[model samples]
Target: MQKKCTLITAAAGLVLALGAPVVGSLPAMAATAPTSSVAAAATTPELGSGGHVFAHGIVTLTSAVYDQGRISVEGVITERVRDVQINAGHGYQAGKVGAGGRFSASVASDSPTFELRFGTKYNAYNFATVESVLWSAVAPGTPPETPGPRPTLTPLPVPADPNPAPEPQPQPEQDAKQPGMPNVLAVSGTDGGWTNDFETGAVESLFTAYDHARREATVTRPTDGTLHVQQSSDGVTFTDRATYTAGGGIGKFTDIDVTLPEGSSWLEYKMWVEDSSGRKSEAQKFFVQEFPARN
Candidate 1:
C-alpha cells in the first residue's frame, strides 16, 4: 500500500494565498435599462391640429350660407346611407333664440330633394352657414380597429381549491342609476307639508345626478320638499318632478343639485316654484360650473 500525503489547509490561509474573496461578500445591485431606450419608449404620438374628416356622407348642400332670413333651399341627398338630417339651428342658436331662428330640420326619407331655411329675424348677411351635414351609419358586424395602445386584459384571478371545489367568482359593481326628471314639490302647507324657507333672495334645487358620460338627461327628484324642480334639454317642454311649499313670503326660493356632465362648459338648471295661494314663482336660472375629470 502506498502512503498517502494528508495536507490540511486552513480556509483563511487558502483565501489569502489565492487572493479571492469569500462567497458572501457584497450586496447585489438593481438592474436598469439603458437611458436611450428609456427615452425612445417614452415618446407619444402627436395629435393633428388642422381640420380633418368628420363623417363619410354626401353633402346635401355644399358650403351653403344663409344670407336672407327665412330663406329656404331645396336639394336632393343621393345615396342616403344613414339618417341624413340637417343641423340648421345648432351653431349659435342652441336653446337660446327661438327654435325657428336656428334649428335643424330632418330631410324626408329616401327623398333626394331637401329644404332648409333660416329664421325671419336673421337679417345679418353671412351671419350663419351650414358647416357640414352630420349623419350616422349602421356598421356591419365586424371587429372594430383597436384604438390607442394595446390593452393588456388581465385574466380574473382565481384562488386554489381547498377541497377540490370550484373557485369563487368576482362580483361586478352595480350599474349606475338611469337619469330621469327631477321631482316637483307642491308648495301647499297643507297635509303635513313643510314650507320652503324662501326669505332669501332666490333659492333653487337640483335633483338629477349626471355622470357626464352617457350624455343623457332623465332628471328625477330625490326628496320631498316645497321647492318644485323641473328638467328640460330643449327648453320647450318642461318635465316637473318635485314641488316645495312656500312659507308665505315674497322672495323666491329653490333646492336642487346640478351635476354637470363631463367635458361640459356650462349647465343650465331651470326651476318653477309657487306660493301657497296659487302664486307661481318666476322661472329661476342656475348656471353650472365647469367640471373636468382628473387622470
Candidate 2:
C-alpha cells in the first residue's frame, strides 16, 4: 500500500498532510529510555514532523516528531475534536484540545514501525505512519533548514547528459549496536530501534491482533495513564468492553477470550488513552484478524 520513491520516508507519506519529508536512523533507541549511543550518521536526517493543513482545512498537525522509538506530536486541532491522542503498539496517551484549539501528546514504541493518528471523538481525523525508520544513528543537534511553504514549480526541459555519475546507494540499516553512538537524533523528545523490525515497521505491526480463543496477543506495549481496548464486529462501529490502567509499562492487556457477538467475523480494536478527568483521545484504530480454526 506504500508508494515507491527512492527518497520516500514514512513521515513524507503522512497521507501528504505533512508539509515536509522526514527520515529516521536505524539501530535506534532501546525499550527503556535511550540508554546507548551509536556512530554519527553520514548526513543528519530530518526529524519526522508535520505543520500542514488537511481534512478540508479544519485539522492541522502542527508537529509530529519520531526518534528512536519514542514519538511525540503537537497539533492545532479543531474544537470539534474533543480529544487528541497518539498510539503505537500498545503504548498510547491522550489529551484534550486546549482552549487555544491545540493539543499535545506522545507515545512510546518497542519497534520502529509506528503510526500516529490525530482525530476527534468522531470519525473525522488524519494519520501519519512511520512505515520504516531509515538511515544511520546520530545525536540530536541543529536540524536542517526546513523548506519554505509549498512552491509552484514549472517543469522545464533540459538537455540530457551523455554520461551521468552513478547515484550513491543508501546504506542498509545497522542491526547491532555501535560503540560510540548517541541514543538517536530526536527532534523534540527530551529522552528513545534501528535493527530488524524496529527499523522497518511500527511497534503495532510487531504485535498481532488478539487470538480470541487464547485471549492473548503477541508482544507487549507501553502504557501511561490508561488503555482502553475496544472491539468492533464490523470494523467501523465499536463499543467499549473492558478498561485497563492497573498495569503499567508494556504488558498484555487483551488476555481474555472474546465473547464473539453475533455476526462477528473480523476482530478489530482501537486503543484510547484516558486522562485523569476520564477524557480520552479517540485517536487511531487497528484490527487483528480472527484467524480461522486450525485443523
Q: Which one wins on TM-score?
A: 2
Instruction: Quote the lDDT for 224 in model 1.
Output: 46
Candidate 2 on 1-295: residue-level lDDT in tens? 1111111122323333344332231233211111111111112333323333332333444444556776554545342445555556684466556775566666676543333334333223333433221122112342544558998899999989989989999864554323332221101100001111222112222322222211112321123311123233222233223332222222234334332221113333444443445554443344333222222
Q: Against the correct fold, how does model 2 do in TM-score?
A: 0.25
**lDDT winner:** 2
Worst 10 residues of 2 by lDDT: 186-195
Clash count, one per candidate: 40, 15
Candidate 2 lDDT at 70 equals: 65
Q: Tell me the spans in candidate 1 whose CA falls farther than 4 Å from its real position.
A: 1-264, 274-278, 282-287
Worst 10 residues of 1 by lDDT: 1-10
Q: Model-by-model lDDT, in order?
A: 0.27, 0.35
**Model 2 stretches astray by more than 4 angstroms:** 1-50, 111-295
